[model samples]
Target: MNLNTFIQKKINKQLIFPFIILAIVSGIFFMSIGFRTTITTSKIELEKAVEKWNNTFTNMENFLEFLSYDNNLIDNTEKLGEILKNFYNKFQNKISYIYFSTSSKNILIYPETDMINGINPNTRPWFINASKNKEKTQITEPYVDHITKDIIITISKYVNGMNISGVIGIDINPSFLNDILSNKDLLLISKNNIILFSENKNKIGKTFNIPTKSERFISKNILLITKEAKGNVYIVTYKNLFLELLPYYFISLVSIFLILFLGKIVNKNINTELKNSIAMPLETLVNEAKNYLNNQTFDSSKITSNIKEIEVLINEIADMISIIEANFQELKATNEELLDAYNEIEKYSGELESTYELFIEKMSNIVEGFDENTGNHIKRVQILSEFLAKKLGLPKTLVRQIYLYSPLHDIGKIKVPPEILTKPGPLSEKEWKIMKNHTIWGAEILDGDPRLEIAKKIALYHHEKYNGKGYPFGLKGELIPIEAQIVNIVDVYDALRSKRPYKKALSHEKAMEIILKGDNRTSPNDFNPKILEIFKKYEEEIKILWDNLNDNK
Candidate 1:
């Protein structure tokens, strides 16, 4: 009645519809059998009667031929009458009367009636028809006898004897043909649509309203099955098709009722089985799972089922919860120990990182030849590189590496002679050659230490120009390491801005102009185009770094 009940019965409805189909199919199957059985049986009975009717006509003709051989038997009217009387006694059932007539107005009809006075042999239908056709006896088609109103056919033989020269005729009543089938009703109908013979005597004299173009057809609410018999039709009529198949119809209705009954019982059994085997256990599984998740209480034994897979699933869920609970306690202790160990490692990492920074700054200070101004100069380069690296969106680890290792770009100056370090004048060509060796020496000093790998590249390739001309190795453009290229631009900027021994520190604007548009000493072509763009875009940020970290600060 409600939604849940309707939905629960949904499967029952789906399962029950097939029984409706089965009932319909069985009904059609039995109905077809009934129709074919009734119609086929009726047709077979009609055919048998047809054969009997043909045989009767043939027997009559044969009898007439045998009688013609006995010339004396047929030549004398007195003897012929005696002979016909004997045949009349023998076949009195099918023969209403037997007669022998000649051309001389002499006629003898057995059980002679006063009607015989009106019957003339010379002008009778039998004599007039058979006398001219002498060899073949002419048998008239089945018709109603006018006097007796019985269905009859007349057969006549022309006998040309020395004494008797006339026709011998017999009048037959063929109503006995209806006795062929005891159960099936049959009719002998004349070609003129007259009912000649019928089991129902009332129908014997009626006109059969035959359909226009069919031997077997439905007529006047009757299914007519007919066979041609001696120019007449042997008919079997079924008045009502439903009444004929009533037995099968009753059986089909009973079968459909039984199917519906069986379907109801099956659906009930299915629901009961599902409730016991699956539904109740699934409900328990949900309830138990909720209790376990909410409160730490689990009792898998409460989930009961007859099905093996359901039992196994419940057991697996219980087992998994048990394992997770046990592992949780162990995991709590393990995580505590790992946290303590992590704190110790991070503490050591901070101290080690600070040591590396102190070591790098000491190295940069040594490379400046203990000069305060140059010391501040390298420190400013570190700040600028860190700021620019962050603006470039470099990863934090890479930015930290660039910030820490950038000041070590001139660490190779440690190997340079002190005269060129603070020459206060232009270097000789030989001293300039010695000056370029600082990049190679710086690479050698920071080499083979992975922690300072970027430092090594900056030292070795920082002097390499984007055009590949300002280097010990002449490494070109992108052939220089990106960290080295970054340091190269930073080194030039600081060198132009710092109060160097050869020149006064240029203003930030003057230095930016010289870097973007070349001075005689420096060219825009010597720097990586990407790093150059960043320097131009963030020139204001670079100016802030220079002012904040200057020697005065």
Candidate 2:
């Protein structure tokens, strides 16, 4: 052959490999785009569901801790239904039932529940496990609820405080949980594909076999994504691995056909289009993929494009920051200790002078927890009530009672709905009416205790205005008891001073001004003239007291 013929043969050989490489690059680019959408969609859905579940878990655990410390529920379950109703309302419709049980009482399920014999919540495995862990929350395997006769999942925590010893928890309805993972592909299953909640209505509460992990092929194009919840339950989603890939494959075929046609001409414009549009992007994707396999940390920024394939690759890389189920750190009482504490509470019923004192302390904390803006409110109320009672020349015994029971004044809030209690804005007329009933609830809570007579009166009639415009009874002037009158002025003063969800914190001068001179919301006429004079007399000292008991400090 001549020199020209040999050069042409060399050129043809080089063209062959370039065509092959172009085919491969085109396939990869479209392939990545195809799978990315499927992966990203599934991942986002799973992440949201997992995040929701985890949040509920954490909140429930914290609430249980609060319950464990609340000893009042030990003897009084009358208000528990109210408390549960408020809590249930706040959690949307996610919670099916909210209940608690002391060693003395069997579990009381909220909503409609049937009385079931031979079922003691305290003796159950969930309660026992939580009691053992005491401080930590525990989850139970899906089981038939004795009251409802439906399969339900439970999360429980043990309660062992000064007056109470028991378990508190919530039951999650599988159907409600299913509604959260609304996508048809999602299935929350318990052990071996026993569907607790399923995308397909017919598949719910039934067994559906998930094909073997290692056997995923075109004929069985299912992709399984799994995250474990407590109690052998799994959040699972089945996505089609091959669905979008075909469309991407078709795009690749078109691109490949174009590349082949362009290869024959090998013109400048075609080369420019091919290099910029296809070759460089594909090369970058390959480099990113390589780095991902080698690198432990993924920077999604490198994915660099909105292409579905890039998204899919980015999501797969995003797996490093996976949602991890958090476990609690705490302790609980033994069965023997629980039993002994229960027995002792009844055994020492007549000797509750000290326990009552303990309850007062906890009630203050509970009140503050219920309303974050309260800030040493019960403490301040006690001080101001005592100071005013002394100023009134009341007997020492009456003064002592005022200080002791003042903290329990707002104890009736347990019956108020949490939505109203924590409202960030002004209540509607109806809500205001509901809010006013807390006084009645408070009185009822403090009832049955002779020592709490002053507290009960304070709770029931504290809001009765000196001008006759206040709530729950609206008894004007001396019709409102002196004990209530004492707390009323103090409650108003402290409320104006504290930062609430709806209002800014007033300066000490502003608070005193609002109380003495009156505002649209408050009236000097609301205060007894004698109590109003005491506030006017000790305004500076009261300011000092408020500044000294800074909650932040």
Taking all chains together, each candidate's TM-score versus the true structure is: 0.45, 0.37
List, residue by residue over 401-441, the lDDT tens digit for candidate 1: 98898888888887777867778888899999998998899
342-430 per-residue lDDT for model 2 (tens digits): 89987798468668877787876786577556677888888878888888899999998898888878887888888888988888999
* Lowest lDDT block of 10, candidate 1: 230-239
Candidate 2: segments with Cα more than 4 A from true spot:
1-17, 36-38, 102-107, 115-125, 128-132, 146-150, 161-164, 184-240, 257-553
* Candidate 1 lDDT for residue 72: 72
Ten-residue stretch with the least lDDT total in model 2 = 323-332
Tell me the TM-score of model 1: 0.45
Candidate 2 lDDT (Cα, 0 to 1): 0.73
TM-score of 2: 0.37
